[model samples]
Target chain A: MATDDAGESLAEVGEFAVIERLVAGRRQPDAVAVGPGDDAAVLRAADGRTVVSTDMLVQDRHFRLDWSTPHQVGRKSIAQNAADVEAMGARATAFVVAFGAPADTSADLALELADGMWHEAGLLGAGIIGGDLVSAPQWVISVTVLGDLDGREPVRRTGARPGDTVAVCGELGRSAAGYALWHNGIERFDGLLGRHLVPEPPYGQGRVAADAGATAMTDVSDGLLADLGHIADGSGVGIGLRTDALSADRDALAEAAAALDVDPMAWVLGGGEDHALVATFPQAPPNGWTPIGRVLDGPPRVLVDDAAWQGNPGWQSFD
Target chain B: MATDDAGESLAEVGEFAVIERLVAGRRQPDAVAVGPGDDAAVLRAADGRTVVSTDMLVQDRHFRLDWSTPHQVGRKSIAQNAADVEAMGARATAFVVAFGAPADTSADLALELADGMWHEAGLLGAGIIGGDLVSAPQWVISVTVLGDLDGREPVRRTGARPGDTVAVCGELGRSAAGYALWHNGIERFDGLLGRHLVPEPPYGQGRVAADAGATAMTDVSDGLLADLGHIADGSGVGIGLRTDALSADRDALAEAAAALDVDPMAWVLGGGEDHALVATFPQAPPNGWTPIGRVLDGPPRVLVDDAAWQGNPGWQSFD
Candidate 1:
């Protein structure tokens, strides 16, 4: 099915032609003052400040091509980076990606990946402004997201104080439970399996939390407790989570946990990659946000129901 | 020499600890409203527009550890991305890096890489805001830079027209010549070899050209003629280089070409990664810019001494 002009491999089509094809016919958002084809892209920051973050996903380490379509990989890459911006109490406006793949990969696959990125970016009303493509032994996608704070002060992890209510605004444990199902080769939970491939981050919720006066915020990239540990350490306060409050999350994954013979609490407490928005508030949380715990006095640790539960803390890059 | 805690590999130190060591006690610029340790960094844009760009460097393909120290690699990464911002007629203000390395790498080496990045960023009064670290089979560094345009209209590649003089600032052919010398194992031209590892882009000259009424501009990341071909194609015009005007650039690389048995003109016309600023001007060129070519009517092509070149055009990622 290979054509003489299109090439059988990326090496055949070459990097420049592939990049040109990837960039062709794509529409940029209004916020983008200057788009791709230049050394850099210029984006308008209406509020005079920009919130920025970056994430890297390596093949086999982050995802297996056999399990995820290139489109799903692209969406996941964009979603995860966008989540970081959301965690900062800002709205993502633009993204610049740097992708590396083997030379023999099909050009069509790369286009599908770009399409997936565009699909996800469209959801946020953001644009893919610029990117660099290169040859590597495997696929490696690195994304950097720029966001606007809308003149509001940033909600940092170091701002949480004792007695602040800890709340969350998205699903948790589904991705980790999906990982378990995928590892065990149990395909019964289709939704959970899909969640592992592409996460559903609650868009526009960061601004909502900021408007509701969030004292501190973060995304659940690492397990809930592990991510909370960062806030505790950064803010120098203890964080205590209530298991009763997370029963809904645990129940959602009870079936998968049973199939894998693991504690559902482990997934609820220690699993990660759900991209859930977690924030602390001095008063009642805004709509769609459910209170899960409270900030405690000094000691700098994340506790489960007032006690330190012993289990796998969270995912480690080396591990 | 291998102490347990002192020289532990990245895997032993873990991602969090390694990051803590990398970011510990580093000073950030005043523009950085938020730095590392948060889910994202917040930077002041001041001018309501942020210029963004991304570049990926792969080990073996982009740089060899044998030829460059981790510090040089870091400097090269930051410098190249900063050149992209400068080309857009903006001042680089901040950067975010996503670095992937094997788990077996030493933590000291990563800290050294960060040290080099900070050193290069300091040249432009910019700060590294945030970054991501993950495990990979080899080293892959991706850098995204954000710049401030200060209310100036962005100089685009599609703005050049017929009757415009093409001018270039900074040296050309030196990086490619240095690469050739290093590839051929000729050590006579140490400065040329160093230039290959870390390009010296003409800093702040892009804004100067833009202020002086240049029509279009781009950085010479690819070879001069090849990069000019982009300007020609984007601007829908032809570019004719006057070889006699490039005598100074040729003379600078003659000794290196003689040492490596390659044509100095080939390096000047077809070498990439020098990152010199090339632009089109309707009138006399700006101070610091030297006239090298002229834009022609109709067809989009780059001519060397008014004739089609018969050599390698430039670099492609896959090739």
Candidate 2:
């Protein structure tokens, strides 16, 4: 990667030339039959089933350019979409991105964004197969991921039943704690601040949970309680969360919470974007999973210690 | 489709309820094993291969709210992405859309947009499997289409050879001509104006061209000459289009061109978004295709009547 002309904008370099630069020297995965520079990319789905999902990140609504670098934005966009496919018990194999940005934005920034996307996709052994770039008032990135189910029945949120053990794999409340730290302009807690910019999802644990006979599962994108409520409602079962079981997550953010004069439990219970996988098992959970709750026979609702949560429920798109 | 509460906005309805309204009562294609309401969608790819493409439409960039309705915008977004899959000689099976709009936007309008997407998807017996809705400063819609190759090798732009006949299926320059008529506020040509808002891509014709032994193919998204230039460059051949052969398309737009005091041939040659399928065949094309050019042995370039045309070449994204 060269930066001889750092000030050159996308409009000055032209769309096709910028695209060529972004795509040059990138190696696609073996699953790609036809990669970039084609009308469409052809991907191999050996299991005869493809799992697909899409997510869009707006400039201010999703992430601010000042807070997250173009590379972090790219990684966050890819990670969130991949988490959706992972929740379905599938392996993400390919991605097609559509990016919109101001014409005066530097072509170098676009390359950085692509680099970040490739960096994250490489972690899963997947490829950034294709994408479209166009001008916009502000930066917008939309990613759609295609995954392989590998002959496994997809884990759905509606499959949970009474007596199932509620377990989770991956970090919780890190993103929320980071967001709060960043918003308050606090310079301390660098890890929490970094987590707010880019989340670390437990990649292979999804298939692990599915193989262990997990009855239901979903990724925590819209807060722990909020996402769990979806599974509870969909399965027509009540969920009871044990605060003692989640003490570790709260303790991890205790310092940040104390500095901001807020309750650490709020972040663990109501924050989102950690992309952790939560599932319900019929019996004791498998390795790398911690039991945090229990599925009970009752009306569809989520109760924290046998009572409703009094803090913010979760993130709302329009609120 | 009842618009009982036209005054309600997305913020009032909430994201989940608004999504429910859009997904309710929609019948998915049989190929979809799991549709909306799940974390992700699962589509059956019987050919063991999936063709994928994506496109993004921005407000006041790709479209205008005052000039086009929400339904028309929805149709245009889906049509453009579907055209990409069609160009690969595949049948589009499912679509996943991610939409961002203002919080104060009407939920009914969102429903109308979904209605328009379903309307277009139904034409191909496809389905709108899943989507994401979020708040933005302006409307932004990004659609990704998944297609099944059905055991057919995808037609690529690099497959053409010297001495092949260049043919086209579907209309040309209509969108560009309509754009001119609308730009000047001359609404007399209602059909042309409507076409400018929502294009009608020649669906299912990509497979026909593939079956007919077409060597190379592309959809006319960036004008006739610009798109043909892609095939020409990729195949390392010269493409000489015959103006006399395109008389029918020119004559059809002559009235609109005359009113705008511009040459109809310019629209036919440089206009884009018509999404007409153009391909090179070793023999005479199948029924419903018209011969328009010839592939010749030379450096890659596109010529009009053995010479270059001095006019607007085509639409450029940055410009």
Candidate 3:
């Protein structure tokens, strides 16, 4: 719900009025044939193929309202969903969001969330075509992204083969590092703390990697090793990550790790939510991508320097 | 997450295992070029246009867990989103769901939710392609439906004219009556209580109405008066409803209304979430549709019996 600068609550502004305010003055791309205020929005999938993915963020569970502004939460929601599309070697075309909050939540906060979504979508030249608003006990944001593959075959998780080189094309462990910093209430490392709230995924690298003959792709939503384990399981191949290949990432995080009195390697290898594009290429990867591992012919498993490491593989929702 | 049919909880099953269990044994339609297990699911929109809409259901706000089984909740989520697509004169083809719930929730409850979704999708020949599972303080489900226009122009809400007849193609007031019954702890009338739990929109009627020269269309999501008000405002015209025309819906709920000591007409005219397709047609509505009102050529508003309605208009999220 929204109103003028008088600072009205969502409950006071009403649902329809808030929707009108959110949609007004917003520009939609050519792909959006029909925008908001309709029963459903029609989007032109020029490539005829639509890549769809969904993700949900709960207050305190995924993001804390106290740690992030509504705008950042909105941006993170869109960014993570966009990362999913990017992982499929597709370009995001549009997004539809569903947000829920208590009735007493401010209309300004609601609009701020939309502003954040538009900001993130604008980064990739996409649009927020439609959304739903509802009342709930706590804040919850769920985003669904639609993308166009533009005639390219989707790079799947099961396409990795023996001799494939595993590479990553975005920051590693930064979000986790930031998360740790935030958890410990550290005041230093503003950049790292910011990254934890809003990740910068390698937006177009999935298509670049695909064009370069990458066989398999996925975003590192979970830790790198854990996400690679999915690719390994999907492809029925073993993956070996060389520590030397990841030394740069470790060094990048060394300062943060030292400040926290933790091992940089743990964050570099086991941390997640960076939304980094990780793929397996049969040959050399495209520029800006770093080769960190290789596929091996064996049962599905991921290794660090040809050996299993006794550490947490990645995040487990329940655990 | 999931395991053998041993009645394991979601916490015990884990996110990945629960997803595997939910997606396993499910068949994806041909339009689904690529299904689950990827960062995103690829859907083939041969018509080149995708109709997208989203809706969110919170645990207590939308449906009480004690009042509804997980299966019913799943069906309601899909049904409501699909109804939006149907209102646009499109057939829902694919859906992506993002579900959040307490970690200790039973894995079987999660599967039951999926089963209910599949059952509803099967009715429309659609598929549930991809999803995300995360831990939340309470259950939250957000669904986005991708529909195909099949080359037909979408019937929007801004096209009704003075001479068009207003008609509806599904039950009305049943959900409201059911809700009231449930709220009053009236144990009798299982059908009314069930209607509150799950609405049965007249599926496939949207395209039928579009093909039969419907000038404007929308789902009765927020009561006949309120939803028609949307059309009136969008079309910049007035709408007048005939009480006699909606006598059938009133009659259907009369017994329940009498038992509950409330006016049946209030439920018929103001209740929402029935997902009934209400449209303005240039002529008598096609078979299976019942006329209820007429379009007026004047200031935008909805009037009952040539006068403004004094009862509650409809449901509002914040209100």
Candidate 4:
């Protein structure tokens, strides 16, 4: 189980021994009563409710080993899943990861992946309680995040009614722009490309939005327009956006857009994976939140500047 | 979202539309307050605790598309994760699945997989509360199960003492024997080969074992010897198996073993993936459980008939 003797494949080390190395010297959080090395992990949910979500990332589809290190993939996996918990107006307490990779993969790479997961979990004060490791043709990671509601009513998507102000926090269009840069083989936008690899979700902002009495909340994963459509469709209310209000976000991506000869507004409107927190507030949103739209009295639809702006709505997995 | 079109691929149907088809017509259990349609699902956990576990399955590695139906793979995925919950002395309430597969895959196959999961979950009175669908090079399914303990204490591996009787419920060595039959192209044992595709764990036996005062328990995911060795190492006790008590299991695999020209006892003692429940009871195990071994005071090791048995210990992911 020792990493001192290197250059062995995972199959040579065996599953149990590799597991021993993956699990060694890691500290579990207080919420985990029975951590890994058990049949199942026991996590305390004092509020009598557990917010759960899952996301699977396949190699080359969700990430590229050539573009990002195993550590970044690990962080991105946890961060994206954690963003879901945050969108639910809950704080993630623990995660159980299931990883599949080729047998010849280095144990050190797996360790670095775990290290990345631990680092991301630490940022949110959570732990990786349990996991399953398996062999696959390519790297596949599935993360399930368990979140605590802290005795608050889960801010569901159905709660956004007429006249609620739509607000967002954290970066927008950054990940999409970063992807564009990396895809185009541009090297000038170091920060944008890095952001695409490892996103910085506005941690704890979910709790703050919840405490501020936000009615409905979700994270921007499938672009602003597409994700807001979820709230619109779920709440059965139309949302109208002010293009002027999103100028700041458009400006943030302007340089990258110019370099790519693309419309910056398109990135701001249709880019995904920034993991920014977007919510609907019956009153003024909390500090550091930007108001961009308002829930309207109409059919379930999203409008840009009181009109339909026809562009690429957002990302879809099969596309 | 409707799957009215008979021959559309996942890419043609699209991710959101495919997800809608997969989730359609499924009734969630009472424990799910909010199911699907949001960033996360909220499950009721009135016990102030939730038991969690996860497992991942990859195509051509964990399962073969030619050998097993998509439905069988789905059942196997859920059944194994449910077994982990059952091992914790908890009743599985909800499951969240993350699935990845090729874009050109048939959408109906995806529905069949969901149907299989729902059918298996119905066996435990649980629900497939939420799921995510994405594109991958091959099929990768990850399932996270959430369970409620119903106020009973979790039977952990560290609680087995020197004198506790090791008892087991459900079939053993069937999957391994079945794997051998399939590998050798022997089609004589229908039951064994079918079992290799979908394991039937003693559905409610974890709670039964707990009610009968089981001190420690685990599922036989790996070989019984390897999993029991985990208990031995965790509890600081040795496990001594009575081969006489395992004659029934060996006999069950004898026909398959004879066809493969292998030892049936080796399969019974060292096979895994049957997902049978193995527990340590201070007294007699509950009715319907078979006594197979005893705990002893010594270093952590597994002995067969008071002596070391040289054989394959169990299945490991890497190996």
Candidate 5:
């Protein structure tokens, strides 16, 4: 159980002992009544409703050990799941993680992973309440986030209507662009590469958007066009984006696009995993959010400059 | 999204379409305010508290496709996670599952897995609220359960005291016995073999134990002795088990043990995954639970008939 041995393999330390080390000295939030050393964790849901979501990151698929440190993978796992909760107009309170890795993996790596998770949870003032560790052929992490809505109605994707303004808060296309940089072995874009590894989701902006009377909300996980298409389809209303409004995002990625000989607008429109909060509002957007589009009275679809722009739409798991 | 084309591989159908098939037509319980479609699901936790737990099952480690159907694996995944909440004296209200598999895996298998999960969740009046699906090299399923404590104190494993009786509700060793029978290719124990595929945890006994004043509680997940040792160590008390108290369990697996030329007591003491509820009580244990041991005022350890039993204690993830 001692944290002194940083080089031991998980098999050498054993499950219970490794668990002891992973759980040692970690501070849990006040909302957690019963923490890790129990059959299940008990968390306060003060407003009578609990918002829940889950996401799994697979080795070589969701992340690469060679490209990412265990810490970054852990952070990405927690951040992505937390983004889902944020999209629901809730503040993430706690997380329960289940991790699987080969037996030969270092216990230190697992500890580092936990440390990264703790760091991310701390940013949101949340706790990693309970987890299960197991042996697998490759590292796989599944994180489930629990969120607090503070008695507000969840901002669902079905609430957008005609005449509503669509806005976004946080960076867009950085993750996809970062992936290109990493994949192409171009190390010059340090900030973009780091953003891809550990995304900075506009955490509390979700509740702000909710309070601002946003009609619908979702996080941009599967590219701007693809994710907004979900909102459009769900709300049975079309969405029209102004290219001029997304010019800043395009400009941000312009240097990288020129370096890669690619279109910067493609990354801005079709890139994913930036975890930016996008919502539709009937009035002027919230202060921190930038209005880039509007809901329209038409069949469900997403248009660029009021026209269907052709390119890669977005990511799909199987693809 | 149509269920008729069950033969297509996940890659051919894509992620969102497969998710639509998985989510369609499932009736959610009243506790679910928003289910499946949204970025996150919302559930009412009437008592201001939520009990949460998670587990991961990897291919050829936790289960096998050749030996168990996708449905069985799904049921096992949900059942095991639900048991953890049950051990905490709460009724599981909803679940969010994250699953990974090869792109070539049939979409039908995924649906069958959801069917199996739904079948098991139905037993507890819970619903599958949300999930993520991704591509991986092999099948990996992670399930997170949410439960309501209904205003009662959560029964933790640190409450046992000297002189308290240890009891168990639900079958013991059946899963291990079934494993041994299947391993040896001696297929006489039909009941045990089926149990190995899908465990039957005593659904409502955790609350019953809590209502009956159980001081310390945990599920028999890592085996009776190993899990009870958790209680013993957490509560700073020793435990003494009476073999006579476990005679019924031994008898149940007697034929299978003989056929495999193994000791029935070993399975009763060391086997796991039966998901039986084990707790320590200050007074007589409630009906439907069999008394198996007593807490001793000494160092933390487990003994059989007042002495340590020399055999395999239980399971470890790395092992």
Candidate 6:
């Protein structure tokens, strides 16, 4: 009874009509000079340069529709892409998404996904400027985010210098713990489970780090140690984590770790998808940042308490 | 022997290692100020404003893997996105692609796909700057193109007037004809079949139209009639085509249409995906353009010889 008697699918609605439904009534931020329905959208890059990054999330691999709602998938997609833009010490201006799903997919679900994207983008004062939708065998969401540096120099991962303090703003490892719980069918940690469904990226803190004279910055999409390793490699320096500084993060996940029979430290150091902002600063960090380590003289490596971590490094696409 | 390899899938390669392998040893163009391995790529947008557009191609819906090689699909994906930039009277400067494919997909096929993308991008002197790769149930390629207007005003679809001459550059209806042939299992037309796989967008002609004082412009991704209808509706005018002027295009496809027992005029008028540059100019058309119609007083519609067309209108995403 829920199905259309005419058996209409996405192809039946047509690309333009589907687009009309997807774009109708969506509010755009001021930065978007033009939105969808044009050949291309025009965005104002206030800083004379636009920071751009892209990420693709596939069903079952990045997310399982059986576990996450369409709204959650939409949020996760935008959140991850926004985190990449934030890592550059810039404020996201607009996003263009390309989504592919089966023709048989419920139109209501698709609308819900758009709602979720708009919801997440609203957090950063950004807009969904343009997008493309097509039918595929499964859901594939690819998002590209454009950011404005606001006249400041973009923070690169290679700028960290010896003696600079490494600090982070936002919670870490909750998503990974949630993922484990979900995989093992343990549903005790509701918050952790929700965190896995939709990550809460540290909003506005990237610009905060830049204004505070941060030398380098990145988001912890990969595990903390693995992401820091990227900074070490790019900056050609060593990074040493002070476990005492991370005790709070570990303690936050202690219960979930206990339930899973895994070390909370492993979740803190080796888990990923938390999207926390980490930066290296020459002076004291910004108001919301917590100092966790120090950038060291080269040999490009990440160490836990001055010793190499022996646990799993992090996630891999091929794996 | 394959079993001895542990039948490694994307899960076995992991995300990072697979990415490392995919990114290894690919030459990047000079326009890529910053390439892959960064949080985001940095490209020099010489002009103050950047024209951006995105398109997503989903397997089975957009292209059948059985009908198209990965290389052809890659080329088609880039060609269509580039056409959008061209439609804006801008030259594509760089592209960021996000590709999702199954884990069991051969690495060689992924390489070939990238190789084809590079091949097409080279034609425009543009660079493939950054991308994201993830595992999906099917092949989904999303491409976002950035273009530079070179200080020229963008020729939007809203600018045409009643007296403007409607003209087009490049072929039309060939892709539709090809699709029909492929669908009907008519194997004789190799050129048409190949054209369907990789469209030859009228590159650089958008600027030509702009320089010729064109009022409105768009690419013929949809059928000519449907595309012109968009220009008509946007510009608050109607468009009337001269059948005699389109004879050349029809003649070129006549033989194939005859073989398939279809009307060549239908293909020429309603076919899509030729990516021909269609624009309205005030006076004599530009050097490379061929005049085909004229803008008329509105109630926005497209007509052929002052009569409504009875053929298929064009392709749509949902249908």
TM-score of each: 0.97, 0.98, 0.98, 0.97, 0.98, 0.94
On DockQ, the candidate that comes out on top is 5
Lowest lDDT sum, 10 consecutive residues, model 3 chain A, at A1-10
| lDDT of candidate 4 over B198-283, digit per residue (tens) | 99999999999999999999999998998999999989999999999999999888878887889999888888999999999999
The lDDT per prediction is: 0.90, 0.93, 0.93, 0.91, 0.93, 0.85
DockQ of candidate 4 (2 decimals):
0.88
**i-RMSD values for every candidate model:** 0.8, 0.6, 0.7, 0.7, 0.5, 1.7
The TM-score between candidate 5 and the true structure equals: 0.98
Report the lDDT tens digits of candidate 3 across residue range B2-25: 223357789988999999999999
Tell me what TM-score chain A of model 6 achieves: 0.96
Cα-based lDDT at residue B36, candidate 3: 89
Model 1 misplaced regions, further than 4 Å = A1-7, B1-6
B148-200 per-residue lDDT for model 5 (tens digits): 88878999999999999999999999999988887888768789988989999
Superposition-based RMSD of candidate 1 using all C-alpha atoms, in angstroms: 2.3
- Summarize candidate 2's per-residue lDDT along B5-113 as a digit string, tens digits: 3678999999999999999999999999999998999999999999999999999889887788889988998898899988998999999999998888889889888
TM-score of chain B of each: 0.97, 0.97, 0.97, 0.97, 0.98, 0.95
Global CA lDDT computed for model 4: 0.91
What TM-score does prediction 1 earn?
Answer: 0.97
lDDT of 1 by residue, B237-305 (tens): 999999899999999999888877788999888999999999999998989999998999979999888
Model 2: runs farther than 4 Å from truth?
A: A1-6, B1-6
Off by over 4 Å in 3: A1-6, B1-6
Between prediction 3 and prediction 6, the one with superior TM-score is 3
Q: In model 5, which residue pairs have backbone atoms overlapping below 3 Å? A: none
Clashing pairs in 2: none
